[model samples]
Target: MIDPIVMIVTMLIVGQIAVSVPILFAKANKSALNLPLAIFLVAIGALALNPIIASMAPNWYALYTALAFPALFMLCPSLWFYVEGLTADTKWQLQKKQAWHFILVAPALIISVMILMLPKETHTAIFIDDTEVSGWFVSLILVSMLIMMLLWLSQCVYTLIKIVRRLSHYRKRLKDLFSNNENKELKWINWLLFIAVCTWIISLITVFSSSLLDQFLFNGTTEALFSLILIWSLIHFGMQQQPALVTDEISPKVKNELIETLDNNKNEQSKASKTALPTKKYQRSALSKEQSKRIADKINTVMQSEHLYLDASLSLHKLAQHLDISPNYISQTLNQTLTTNFFDFVNQWRIEAAKPKILANEATILDIALDVGFNARSSFYKAFKQVTGQTPSDFRKAHQT
Candidate 1:
């Protein structure tokens, strides 16, 4: 009788390959994430095929093992690259520095080659018969597997920490760069990470447990189920996620200037922290208090006169363009003078505009939300409550009564 677990894993491998084809071939609205994501799925599917091949087709198992074991080293790095692609401010391409992430693969490849070159009886004793085999080669293979497993575990922990930090920085950057960040937050990735952590925990348990417990949970079924969930969620969310920064919208000169200014600011902050000196953000900024005040006034004049807050698509770059100022300066003025980010500053104006409309109660809440530069009612409600300390309906009821 065919084991149900083998059947499930087989289906999963097929599903992963099936989904990856469309992603790999997708040409419309191409993203840097596409190739990494496809590779990630295929790598995972290859890993999933390991046991099925071992048991069902023992002849091909050595070749499959040679390929799949090495692929374990690529899993976490592929995931890291995908997150990096998502959070990158510019076009993300693989950098030469990242090649080191796959260094562990070399040892796994060496061990796999040894397995292929091993004597037929020895290979059969180790992999097929599951009989006790003790020799220098056997010891070497066992030690290598143990070392690779530990390295893979360490890679998982490190990748998770890096991804968490990267997501934090990405969110902060979004606040600085955008007015309304509805779908760009990538919260789904957080849930995906949570699922991934849970899956890793299960794998750890399986790895360290006795043979009895391993039979029940470590037989690939539990991990396969979790993998299925994680991959499906990634596919669903990744396909819809647009690049965080729409670099094409800003001209190359402006984009280069903004990137340079931001990089310089980061370098300055790093130096300041190292020096243990108390320095205000943008302390090196040439925008003096006088200039800041002038800029602030100009900003208010333009906002009040032009009502730019009513445009849901307004962004820091767009505002900077309107005032014929650099985006870095606008960001600095907003942070240093106004004590708010571009997102909160614009949203506050939007909420203020929404207040009178809510009081008038002439239109539906959703209609009012759309009128005041909110693309969605949920966002409008959240902002309204944040500014007013009451929900829109509750505020309306209190004021009207």
Candidate 2:
């Protein structure tokens, strides 16, 4: 019979499996679903690979280990694909063949891991190894898994950093800045995807560090960590509120051409939308475009006098007051013409101005970041990433020599 601690651990493993398995099948390619699925697979696999759990429930353990390995490799690619779909403002879809790619590797990797158990495959047995394995075979498994994990991890990390860089400027409308919500609320789901990816990373760390888990168990820290991780996983798994679904055969070619002409084009070559003014100088019933431009020009003059952008904390209200225009007018002017909010408009200017100074090397990242109106390092990193599509370090390096 399994000891009490072993039984408790086994139940914990089962609970993780129970929560994650269904999510794995349900949330495929969806950012909200993708990371949760990865988390679930890692949690289940980590438990199965845990020495104590393996000793207590060998069959279940082996089955889970086999399943989780390739999933580990697949998670990052799937995440990148999901981000691509998000970038495109569409629901991700994988054809049948693409869905089964992980399964192709499953049988072989699993079979190899369980090669010694061929004779005892049918027997319900548990084996515990107290001594740490330092042999060639164990090392091979560890090294291979590490390499795969690192590769997958790197791909996701790079993509997320890129995503963060691309989305850092907008403070008020961060959701829409990083994602599109024209068809469905994909933006909201992308936030949950970030959480799920972090949870998946936690699960991976827990699973691959059996000795550390044993140490924690000995020091009575396992329960606390497990509880936190379990709760985190549960929260991440719950991210599948509703998928951005569309059933119609959307006109791909026409939409693609339009997107290429408008969305991707640096040049403004498409007709303005029905609601948008054909010319920037359209007459308004209450305040004409000429009047608005006068107001904007006066505000620009005041901004130059006060150097408001240097404040970094300057807001719509303050700018509007100084310009003798309502905040609504300022917001509308920036949004309609610049295709961005007032906050983003100002921040973009600051970040752009800072880039040259960053290249000049008169100040460090922190000083330049703060000088550009960003209060914190994180905000600085995010703002720079958004404006430049690269980190400050990257941007600096590119222009330094």
Candidate 3:
């Protein structure tokens, strides 16, 4: 009888392959994300399939095992690249500098090849029967496997840390750039990383434990289930993810100039902190304090008169175009002078606009929320409570009584 664990692992491999093929071949889905994502899915599938093949068909397992280490090494880096592709401010392309990420794969591949070159009887004795084999070649293979496992674990730790930091910076940049960050937040990625860390911890514990504990904790069923969940979540959320920085509306030259100015200002600020200068944010900005005040006033006047905040799709770039200023400068003005981010600055106006309507009590709260620039009622409720210290319904009750 086929083991249930074997069935589960088989299903995971099949499911990943099913998802990966369409993504790899679909022309419409071509982007920086697709290639790494496809590779990641396939690599995971390969890794999951390795043990099943070893038990069911030992003869073919030699070649299959040769490829398995490289697959294992590819997993974390591929996931990291996918995150990089998702949150990149510009179109992400694989660069030569990123080649180092795959360096471990070479040594892993070489060791796998050495193992493959060993005699078939040796493979059966060492892998299938789990017999102790003492020779220079066998010792080399065992030592290499141990080193690879350690390196892979370290790589997982390092890459996960990098991914978390990247997500933090990406979210911060989103606040500076977009007013409505509803779908673009990529919060699921955080959950995915958490699950991955948990799975890694379990596997680490299994590795250090006795054989009986290892059998219980590191069984095929548990690993396959975790892989299934991770792959499904990754595919579902990743397919819908759009580039965080939408560059289609803004020209490349203008975007580059704005980015350069922001970088220069940051560098100046960092240098100033070393010398114990007035540690004000944006202290090196070309916009003077008077100009910042003027810009802030301009923003308020425009919001009040034009009701630009009423546009649910309002963004720093769009606001900059309306004000005839750089987006970075507008962001700088909001942060330094107004002491708020673009998101909060705009949403506060939306909440204020929503108040009189709420007090009038003539329309449904959802209706008022939609009419006043919030895309969804939940966001409206959140912002309203945040800004006014009362829910819309509570505010109405308080005022009406």
Q: Mind giving the per-residue lDDT tens digits that candidate 1 earns over 1-401?
A: 34787578667756867866476658424665676777777787887776677768878876786788888888888889989988887888877888998888889899889888777777778776778888988898978888889888888899999999988877877888778888998999999999989888887778667455545456566777787788778877876787776586678989975665455334234433523643455666687778888999999889999999999999888898999998888877776667667888899999999888889989999999899899998988898899889999999999996
C-alpha lDDT (0 to 100) for residue 390 of candidate 2: 96
RMSD of each: 3.6, 13.4, 3.4
TM-score of each: 0.88, 0.42, 0.88
Error of 1 at 254 (Å): 1.3
**TM-score of model number 2:** 0.42
Ranking by TM-score: 3, 1, 2
Off by over 4 Å in 1: 5-9, 18-32, 120-131, 207-220, 261-281, 397-400
What pairs collide in candidate 2? 165-385, 165-386
Please report the candidate that would top lDDT against the real structure.
1
Instruction: Score each candidate by Cα lDDT.
Output: 0.80, 0.51, 0.79
**Candidate 3 regions with alpha-carbon error over 4 angstroms:** 25-30, 205-219, 257-284, 361-364, 389-400
Candidate 1 least-lDDT 10 residues: 265-274
Q: What are the per-residue Cα lDDT tens digits for candidate 3 across 1-401?
A: 44777677677667767866576647335575677777787787887776678767777987888887789999988888989988887777777899899989999988988988889898878877788888999999999999998898899889988998888877877777777888888999988987777777776666556365545556655656776777778878877788877575678866875565335334223333434543455555577778878999999999999999989898877898899997777877776667677889999999889889989888999999889888889889888898889899898889885
* Candidate 1 whole-model C-alpha lDDT, 0 to 1: 0.80
Model 2 per-residue lDDT tens digits across residues 76-180 = 445444444344434545456655534424543654465343223322222233334455655555566556556656766775776554333211232212121
